[model samples]
Target: MRIGMIGCGVISQQYLASFDQLPDVQLVAVADLDPARAAAAAEGREGVRALSVDELIADPAVDTILNLTIPAAHADVDLRAIAAGKNVYSEKPFAVTTKEGAEVLVAALAAGVLVGSAPDTVLGTGTQTARAAIDEGLIGSPIAATATMVTPGHERWHPQPDFYYTPGGGPLLDMGPYYLHALVTLLGPVASVIGAASRTRDVRTIGSGPRAGESIPVSTDTHVTGVLVHESGVLSTLVMSFDAVATSAHPIEIHGTEGTLAVPDPNRFSGDVTVHRLGGEGWEPVPTAGGYEEAGRGIGLHDMAVRGPELRASGELGQHALEVMNAVLESAHSGARIEIASHVARPEAVALEDVRAAT
Candidate 1:
């Protein structure tokens, strides 16, 4: 797959690094609203051209678009790419709204182009191993789960922290995809959700970079909690916050009749998956049992490149997760349980294997 990466931001660095290790993908072109950033990204890379965003999308040599743009631009970029007869792999949340996300998927489907989304972190060994444990009945009859992600705020470190506080940039929307995607992967599609949310302040002061001390207005929920009723009847509790100081809780914990599974943070590619049997003494480390070993951000794109329709981090799953999240927020505002209209099968598992060799 020849990739034309549409946003040259901090996250793009990880994908660029992974492209070198992935034989199935090629970084053919790069683009960003900031032309200089695009040029810098292409510097010293063999045969990589830095083109305008429009030029890159129109470039017939590019088979797929790696849309790393801001959340607000996700669906637009994806739709444009699909219209140009190119496949798309977008960064998370799918889109700012469920309507927009659905539009992107519908367009891609009609165009006969593949669509994939990020938070592919689930395709990594950490979450995959936990799934394997449940599948193997180490944790029999899955019952419930708890997912927690808390931080003081992204303003503490993100250079351009304005977007983190906007409509599409709150704690749940910005960071929930990783956890939600993992939950669906471990449990199943969510059937309904009830959520409550709060924001501590109206503005956040930037704590780093040239914008230090600059305050950005907040228009979205900062601390979001919800109960996700999975289709399988498992209830997952979620707590996503940008107003918290710290936490010692495991990123995710799945409880079942036989045992419990401790899942690693879904933001990364790897971690130790520990399991505690019902009658066992303590948590024991589960051997890596599934997913691409030593994977990275672009592994989903590689999965799409290799698996075609069988790709795990597919747009259907992405849109389903996106709708589930939006429903959570809507439920918060309406004070009612929101029913999810979308459903997706849990993606196929990746047996423990070196991604580098697969390519």
Candidate 2:
């Protein structure tokens, strides 16, 4: 899968670093709204070229478009790539809204191209280890879980934090996908959600970059709390916050009849996954039993290239996660339990192994 990477930004650096080791995928070209930025990305690379978005999409050597555009442009870029007969793999918060996300899927289906999404971090050992425990029946029958993410705000470090406060951005919409994706990966699809949300301030002062001390409008909820009722009857409680300074909570925890598993951050590639059983005195570590052992961001594209329709980090999963996040916000405003209209099968578990293709 030769790739044309779109968007040259902070997140793109991670994917750039990752592409070097993924044997099944190659970075053939790159593009961004800013031509200068695109050129800079291609500068030291021997075979990679910087092209306009239009040129990259039409480039015969580029069979896949790695979309790293902002949330608002995800669907548009995806639809464009699909139109040009290219497979697309996007960064998360798949799109600003479920309607937009769904449209990306529909177009891909009609175009006969594959669509994939990020937070492929879950395809690493951290969450996958937790999953292996569950599948091994160490956690017994799953019952409930909690996923938490908290921060004062992204303005403290991000050079450009304006997008994080707008409608398409928020604690739930921006940071929710990681936790939601992990939950779905562990528990299966959700059936409904009950939500409540709040915001601490109407304006935020950017703390870094050229825009330091500049105030940006906050149009979305800064803190969101919700209960996702998985179709399997596992209830996952979620608390995502931009208003909080810190917390002692684990990134996630799964409770079942026999034990409770402390899952590492789903946003990372690997961590110690531990479990405490019914009569245990302390938590014990679970060995890594799945995912790309030393993998990084672009590993999902590798997965897509090899797995075809069974791609784990699928566009359908991205859309389902987007719908779940949006439904929670709708429930927050309406004070009603919102039922999810779309359903996706839980992606097949990653086998415990290294990602290197067989020699």
- What's each prediction's TM-score? 0.99, 0.98
Minimum summed lDDT over a 10-residue window in model 1 is located at 350-359
User: Can you write out model 2's per-residue Cα lDDT over 208-294, one digit (the tens) per residue?
Assistant: 999899998899999999999999999999999999989998899999999999999888989999999999999898878887898
Kindly report which residue stretches of model 1 are placed more than 4 angstroms away from their true locations once superposed. Answer: none
State the lDDT at 75 in candidate 1. 95
Mind giving the per-residue lDDT tens digits that candidate 1 earns over 59-78?
A: 99999999999999999999
**70: Cα error in model 2, Å:** 0.4
